[model samples]
Target: MSDKEELYCIPSRYRKTENLHIVFWLVKDLCWVMLWKPLGLIMIIPTLGAALLITWQTRAIKSELLHNVAVVFWITANAYWMLSEFYSTDDSLRYYAVIPFSLGIITIGYYYLGLFSKKVR
Candidate 1:
């Protein structure tokens, strides 16, 4: 091939790059959600203690962590407004709290799942 033509040559269709991008992101999200919320919060202390056993474990200051932390706190605080419904029994207020809590959980899961794949490198 001439030098000019060589630059334009494309690779054969047989070669395909493996894409794990979506999968990695999903894993990060799952971890974040499962670790951040109250159910997950209960596990955090033990989780961190376990991490100390791994000398090579890398720590990343991911924005996702900050985001998840905010979400967890937000949901927890709103939970009072949630439970307050039981006193006077206003179902709507309690129902409203569910949305934020659910959203926070999903965000946490999505973001944290991405972290696992990142740390491997």
Candidate 2:
């Protein structure tokens, strides 16, 4: 598909998401908190906390961009978590929780990146 078409196209599930664009934007607000949580002593609890925050932000946002980011993050995290838990038996198990939380960081990072990415500047 053409880039323009891809940009304009809306999915059936996201038709309702447009109303939440601002709340979705708020997900970026927790980037530092997410990063610090993983490094703290009680890692598992922080991991769960990050996941819950992302889940909450996804539900709170109405924008298609935010929805897409949230859905993609959720799917990727769950897949990795399941694979690590069932398929791998290594020291990297903590990543199953950490990587998912990283998505929120990425989402926030994107907001800043995209701000400069626009040609109008």
List TM-scores for all candidates, in order: 0.33, 0.35
| Model 2 bad stretches (over 4 Å) | 1-62, 94-97, 108-121
Error of 1 at 112 (Å): 1.4
lDDT tens per residue, model 2, 1-121: 7766645444554444443433432333243245333322233333434444445545544343564565556545644554455446685884766676688567867766776677556
Highest lDDT: which candidate? 2
Model 1: per-residue lDDT, tens digit, 41-85? Answer: 334333333323221122233553446454454445343442343
Residue 72 C-alpha lDDT in model 1 = 50
